[model samples]
Target: MRVFQLGLLSALALASVPAQADHHQEASSQQAEHLDAGRWVTLGTRAGPVTSATRSQPANLLVAGDQNILVDVGDGTAGQLAHLGIQTAGIDAVFISHLHWDHTGGLAAILGLRAQTNAPPRLKIYGPPGTAELVSGLLASMVPGATAGYGVPGAPRADIQQMTEVVELRDNASVELAGMTVTVRNNTHYSFAADSDLARRFESLSFRFDLPGRSIVYTGDTGPSAAVEDLAKGADLLVAEMMDVDDTIAMVRRNNPNMPPQVAAGMERHLREHHLLPKDVGELAARAKVGAVVVTHFAGREVGDPAHLEYLREIATNYDGPVVIADDLDVF
Candidate 1:
């Protein structure tokens, strides 16, 4: 697989300002050759620690085939998509794993790009629960000329992407797309967006795409949950988050005064309730009988030292399948 580098810009800066429009096009176009892959493309491929905190990679992603979908578009997703040489309007649907700013920040940018393109078709977006509102707001916020000539708006975009038919899944259910329905269901991952009071447990989600030759699961920012195993059963790929379990425990143990105890507790709770440690993920993949695994959504203390990678490797040992640490722009 080939990887491409995109110029630096914030999601807000990229969308709010218009001066960079030409730059987004020109800069992204240079990497066209690098981006032209056989089948799949990582429009934005960064292992994000949190929302809008990527210093190394973009969060937007593109999977093109009988279907064209953008997954978890993050802060620089707009520029990243441009860099990857994908037309925003041409995109069929956007599948957001969760409701986090970092993951969906470029949503507005993509819309802006659509406005710029003004193509024959619009765009359709699929998300867990609050997806429609987020997409609606994002679409409403774009500047007019952004996609006027490139394509149609909203619903029309769904037609070109092969998701013309709408299939609704139960809260924790799975559905397929493009002649193939992987599994999509809610998981233990919970966030403020899912719940306002933050007392009662909330619902986040993951998706498994079981294609003819490939089966992949995107564990969208989750904690340890058995639901994942149910969806990931026998998957060819597992795009999971990488929060080291030991690291999580260490953070709890350190309990520095600089760290807000409430925030720490909240984080700890989230990790406990919503995410998976590297080792735990490996075990899940192994138990699920997956063929290959790709881990992502890496938010934790710096893993620069060989120790972190070693930890990942150790955890992955549980799974007999091939394991790859997904960085930004790594295509499988």
Candidate 2:
């Protein structure tokens, strides 16, 4: 039930901001402006931090169109933002899909930015229920009542009044901001709130952002949830995850040796159920009529150079529209 004092002007203020991002602008023009700094860049998408295959950095994306809103925040995010000439505290909103370390580990800078800026606007972070607690705990762990550092020159404006608005976004649940409607939906996955008094799987979120003429959907993390089609109803872009078909199966085989022989038959079924398969994405796009589909969050196998890329391309057979296999900073 967190409320911002400026809710009445929320829409009007946002409306004053830019609605249509620079989608129609020429790449050459955009490139020239960003020549000193790479126009669209890649921050961190490497497989892992270790020599071992499983150790990999999390996935994240940033958009600086009309108003700045981050889609996700993962490891190396601080540097990435720095590279893009963006101030950590300057971000207006951070839209987290789910609370996986890979997706949000770099949030340290969020609070850090506030501390350095003298407790500016209580950053209005929007996420699931657990998000508020996480932000509070993280802030407390770093410094007690860091909010007290209330005034600093050139510091970010803080609004502690609306610390964390954990919007439990369900089907069709939308909020008005900047002349756009951000529609949210539940994306069911294996991840769930744990059995402890503290919920375990309460750590993830996905979203569909409808900004003016263009709409984009970020399926934070999901296997194959029908809710995606619903959330992405008519988005221009559907950014999704892609795990290797064979690699995933292999991992399951290694981890679960007690599987029945019939279990092998269910791999295909499970793949669709837990994650968005390449082919399935095409079908989803066509069915949902989203303008385009972009696949990212690549496993090493799926992202393997030219050969693996072609394999992923085959998945596009299911749909008829523009498809993008994402890199770090590929702007929409």
Top model number, lDDT: 1
**Model 2 over residues 1-332: C-alpha lDDT tens digits?**
01111211122211111122343344445433422211122244432212234322544443434445666667767666664566666666667666656666777766676556654455556776566666767666665344454545554544544444444443446776545567677676443444754344363456776654456677766776677778777766677776666666666667778878787667546554666656666776777877666666665453446757664576667776666565554444
Q: In model 1, where do residues sit more than 4 Å from their true spots?
A: 1-64, 143-176, 191-202, 245-260, 300-304
**Candidate maximizing TM-score:** 1
lDDT of 1 by residue, 1-332 (tens): 23321111111111111223454565554333322221234444444433324443335353534456776777776665555455666577777777767677777766665654554454656776666666666554553443343465553322222212223333566555665565677776664554465413334668876655355677777777787888888665567776665465565556555777788777667666666777788888878887666666664545478776775677667966666665555554
- Model 1: per-residue Cα lDDT at residue 26: 58
In order, what lDDT does every prediction score?
Answer: 0.58, 0.56
RMSD of each: 9.9, 9.9
Question: Over all chains combined, what TM-score does candidate 2 have?
Answer: 0.68
